[model samples]
Target: MEINQWLNSAWFWVGIVLFIVIIRDIFIQKSHTITHNFPVVGHIRYWLEQIGPELRQYIVANNREELPFNRQERSWIYASSKNENNLQGFGTDQDFNSPGYIFIKNAMMGYNPPVNHPSKKNPGVLPATKVIGLFHNRKRPFRPYSVINISGMSYGSLSAKAVESLNKGAQLAGCYHNTGEGSLSPYHQFGADVILNIGTAYFGVRELDGTFSMDKLKQKVDENPQLRAIELKLSQGAKPGKGGMLPASKINQEIADIRHIPMGKDAISPAFHAQFSNIPEMVDFIESMATETGLPVGVKSAIGKLEQWEELAAYMAKTGKGPDFITIDGGEGGTGAAPHAFADHVSMPFTFAFAKVYQIFQRHDLTDKIFFIASGKLGFPEKALLAFAMGADSINIAREAMMSIGCIQAQKCHTNHCPTGIATSNKWLQAGIDVTLKSERYYRYHYTLVKEIAEITHACGYEHPCQMTMDDIELSMGDNNRTMTLSKAYGYHKTAIAYEYFNELIDCPHLGGANARNRLSR
Candidate 1:
């Protein structure tokens, strides 16, 4: 009677049927070679592969072993965004003996009587903000409320809801959001300051022929009251000297209309700007744009050869004018889509490039005229302090901000399958994002980061980041016994230019014979 009851059980019957079906399909299916060979057993391998990332994240890898951003770094960002307790017991998981490690030279005690104003109600302190474009050339200068700001993630690269949330967060946090190369969308109209970035393709200000249009640009600036400044993008760190890539899946009607491109097609900017091929032409282009908009204009580029930078500085010094600022991006920058070769192999990393560029500007006495904005993977207070020590007046952040808005760092940005709804254009994916809630998270993250910077500055015996110099930073030599400060390691100072090299290159009558002159003129 017991045997008959067991045989008649619903669960027993269902399990038997399921097993029979799986065995039959595994053998019958010809598509997958492994399944055809191994039958039911092969599915286990496929299932494990499907859940590999989560398994590695939760069960296999340690806190600091991941790339792009480690588990511990992401945890801090998430906690800060939620305004949750981010404190951890004991010391850090970082390996102090690791090569190229960076650490600050902390003071014995806090800055005298607290550099920031004393607060009775709220004990937390705030970092003092700085002003950009403060030189005599500009009619208006932009004083951002914080030195850390949202970097150039475009509207098409992000969803409408994401862009709206970031803009709202920028407004709430008293910072600014950069409108990336895709140009302006209506979603960017939230009450916040904006840095309108014009890439090689000249999206928002481009004419029907794909050339820059002064009328369109003037109209755009006129319409958007939140416009604070303009950035002319020469190259970015992820793919220096290459244009941006927008996959066809994200190119909706709204994005196509704003970018003035055809719908249902991949939008790729030109590798180089067509408007200017020479230094004089580039300078003229920037001056004209600044004159037209009456807004401070700047150029953004990733470092290539050091000599090219010296040449650029020499040109600006000789010409007596150039862009109001120059944004230097590190090679580790994030991108929506790029060739793996360019993203990994091209451009100088931020630390080396920032130090070199800062020295060049100082050598030519152009530091006062052109502000330096450092970007690329500087999301936390320690990294931000390192940037200030390296001579960056302000900094930009992208991936960390995305993390605050629910991005899981799945690294599916190039694919349209961003599970968190931050990078995809699919309405179904975008539905997961709640703009109001995410905006608050964004504000809180920025607020917390800024407060931490203030606290670190006080601990470093400086009233502000500007007061802290290369003397305050120490780079580990990896031997665990030796370290060096920024001032000594840089070893760069003003010196007379090599007149012979310049005279032969620039003012030579033959310019190394007529053939060379003709080749250069063309």
Candidate 2:
């Protein structure tokens, strides 16, 4: 009687129907070779493959084995953001003998600040040693409160909540936030100072014919009081010599409105700017923008061929009409999406690229006239210090900042299905992010990073990071346990002007650096 009832049950019938449907679909699916060949068993294989990354992240991969960012790196960022103890118990697991390993040469006596100094009380209070645009004398020249700032990330590239959290956190952390080439959105107005990045598309300041519109640019500058400077992006590290693309799936009404583009179509930026064809014309364009807005103008690019850079530096030295700052993006930099070849092989890495550019400007005696900002994988203390020693006045962080605000390195940024709600436009995915909570995390992460960098600066016997020279670092040569000083390795030599501002800060007690210290004391 029990067997007869089980055979007639609806549950059994439903299972039978499901099995038949799955088997039929597997055999008939020509799109997937495995599914067609192996039928039902192949379904299991596909499911496991779909979750392979997660399996490796949580179980299979060792702490140092992961690419882009290792498990150890992610843990440090997570702990810092959560305000938890970030100290490691055992000695470093790093293979000290490996090539490319960096070692900081500590001083016999670390820098000791005055007993009454504010930095002595809160190490995170360290400020930039020099004022941006002071040499150029922009009408609105100001010192960036923190040497570390958020990097360019467009509104369309990030979810609304992510943008809101980053801007709000920038305000809390006393760092500037860059509004990337996708254009400014309401989410970026959360009390943070803004650096508007103008890409080849000129999304925010473009005419109907896709040409530069000076009137529109002026309007944007006038409308935003917190707007500090303008960055003209020639190319980013991720895909140098290529344009950016925003897929149609990520485009919403708000994005369309902000970018001034039509809906239901991919937004493509031109590979080259329509405003200027050559370096001289580019310089003139930068000057015009600065004059129009009374703000500092800068250029950002990834290193490629050397002739253009040499020409730019020579022209700037001869004419004195170049950008107030220059940002060098490393080839290792991240992006929402890019072609594999360009991302892997197009431009030079940050360390090499920056050295070359710095040397060029140094030869021309133009290093001091412009601020040098570096962006790559420089969020950590040692890396940031290396950048500073390499002549970087300030450093910008993007992927690390994203991790602070809940990115899991899922690498699904281009798919519009980001598990962490950071790089997605879907409402359901976005709901996972809590603006208030993530903003605080970002603040903590920024504060802790700056504080740690200050600690490293003191350890190297320097009161300010700008005082660090290439002589303070050594890199392993990966042979016979050999090591070489950065100065010897890269032939890097800092010009007299490189230390001019730091010397002035030391001599003048009423300067901006001292004033910042006084403000912190109060």
| Model 2 worst lDDT window (10 residues) | 509-518
In candidate 1, stretches whose alpha carbon ends up further than 4 angstroms from where it belongs are 1-43, 112-130, 492-522
Give the alpha carbon lDDT tens digit for every residue of 380-499 in model 1: 988999888777767889888999888888878877778988887878999999999999999888878877876788789865665567778877778667888877878653222211
Candidate that scores best on TM-score: 2
Clashes found in each candidate (C-alpha, N, C closer than 3 A) = 0, 0
Candidate 2 residue pairs that clash: none
The local distance difference test score of model 1 is 0.77
Clashing pairs in 1: none
**Ten-residue segment with the worst summed lDDT in candidate 1?**
494-503
**For candidate 2, lDDT tens digit of each residue in 438-506?**
999999999899889888888889878888888899999886779998899999766533344433433
In model 2, what is the error at residue 304, expressed in angstroms?
1.2
Error at 473, model 2, angstroms: 0.6
